[model samples]
Target: MKIMSVFGTRPEAIKMCPLIKELQSHTEITSVVCITGQHREMLKEVLETFTIKPDYDLNIMKKEQDLFDITLNILDKIKAILIKEKPDLVLVHGDTSTTFSTALACFYLNIPIGHIEAGLRTYNMTSPFPEEFNRQAVGLVANYHFAPTEQAKKTLLAEGKDPKSIFVTGNTAIDALKTTINPNYTHPILEWAGSSRIIMITAHRRENIGQPMEHMFHAIKRIVEEHPDIKCIYPIHMNPKVKTLATTILGENDRIKLIPPMNVIDFHNLLNKSYLILTDSGGIQEEAPSLGKPVLVMRDTTERPEGIEAGTLKLTGTTEEEIYKQFKLLLTDKVAYNQMSHATNPYGDGFASKKIIEALLQNKKD
Candidate 1:
């Protein structure tokens, strides 16, 4: 089987690289990797961590690029590659412009698409901006839906996706964790944090950019100020607005360290060592639970409701008061913290990549 796996962005690369490695192990499968370069430097970090050299790089990233730029550029560039490779199946991960645009190109060429981490939904399109729209649009045309959980499979069924087409493969994010996390890993930041409790932060959602983002930062700032023993390390996103806002609110605090994004290995190890996490990001909701870290999701709504139900994540919406309340509760209440930390991760074991490849092989035989 000639299978082309298409993805861009750091999160997608983290999840997809494990599956790509799985694809390469099978003699019958020709694994082709194509990166859109939607996230450039951050994406490069992950690819290097996994030692994945792409067969094709779209290199479509630019200064101040918007959804229109990403969508149009990917649509224009990936079509020719699809025409040339003409793989038996094209796989896309999650809901970036890369996934949507690449799937559309495959649709145009009559190439079957297998969507990894599929069937996730917030239904509130405006909250996650283009991501909610992107995933739903991909669902409409995907030949196979590799759902991360039974909840995701249920969502796909409710949306009228074919029953036989969906498989409840555990999240590949967990699969990536198995490879990257090192118990003996040490970094300068870890030394700086010393005996202080580490609160790892990642907030770069498009919808949270302006005032909502400020609310999240302010809440974290309050927590850091109140707690002398805890230190915050926010690996700031590449977005300039996020950089400026974060610097303004969180930069000067001695307890808060606003640093550039770390590679996946460092980031995962940091998450492993952290006392807890705070974010408006999607992948972290799944990733943190596996590491036994309690996550405070600073968002109005989340598509990953499984994490909330499993008690590993708390949806503390984007507001200064609400975020402050939740953040304080987690710190002060040991019972609450232990309950969240010990909660069973509903995402998956560490073999989602193998399951995904098995599904493809079975489909090929059938």
Candidate 2:
């Protein structure tokens, strides 16, 4: 069977790379990769790291492209590739404009689509902006839903997706960790963290852009000031707005190291070595728990509640006081930290690629 996997952006590339490799391992299957290049330059590093080259590159990225541009560009260009490849099935991952657009184009062509990392829902469409809507839109048309957890499956079931079609395959993000977080991995960031309790911070979400971002930054700043033994490594995202805000608020702190964006390998390795995590991003919510790192989610509402219930994560939201209090308590209280860090990862055991492949092959036979 020939299976085409379509994705854009670094997160999608990282998560999908494991599954792509899994598909390649089978003698009976041919894995075809198509990149929309929604995140052209940043995505190349991940693809190179994983050693997965594309049979098709849409080159859809434009300078300062909007959501509408990405969606329409992908929809227009991918149609030709889908027709030419004529894959047995198409797989799209997570809640990106590329994911939704690829799924929608497949729907228009009446091709079967398997949604990787399906069934995540924030419910409030505007909070995550279009991502919440993107996943929901893909859910509407996806022939197979590879839900990462039971909660994700429940979301699909509640939305009336076919029972047989929805499989709790665990998160592919964990699968990516197998290749990414290596024992020999080294970085300059690790040098600064040293023997101190390293807190890896990543906070840049559309919802948390202005005041919310400031609140999170201030809270981290407070924690660093109060805790002399702790050090932080914040790999700031590429958004100029986020960069400016981070520099202004977190600038002069010796303990708080504000660095540029890290590739998946570096980021995952950092997560593995870190004592704890604080983030507003969706992917880290799933990935950090598997590393036994306690996460203080900086968002008000999360699509992944499995971590919270399992004691691996805490929702501190974007409020300055709330964020500060949680950070302080976790740092000072040994029992609280241990409980969160030692919780069994509900996300996956890093076998998600195997499950996703089996589902695709099973459907192919049917």
The most accurate candidate by TM-score is 1
Model 2 segments beyond 4 Å from truth?
Answer: none
Each model's lDDT comes to 0.94, 0.91
Return the lDDT, model 2, position 153.
Answer: 94
Off by more than 4 A, model 1: none
TM-score, candidate 1, is: 0.99
Instruction: Judge candidate 1 against the unseen true structure and give its global Cα lDDT, from 0 to 1.
Output: 0.94
Clashing pairs in 2: none
The estimated TM-scores of all candidates read 0.99, 0.97
How well is each residue in 1-366 modelled by candidate 1, as lDDT tens digits? 899999989999999999999999999999999999999999998999899999999999999999899999999999888889989999999998899999888888899999999989999989788999999999999999999999999999999999999999999999999899999999999899999999999999888999999999998998888999999999999899999999999889988989999999999999999999999899999999999999999999999999999999999999999999999999999999999999999999999999999998998889
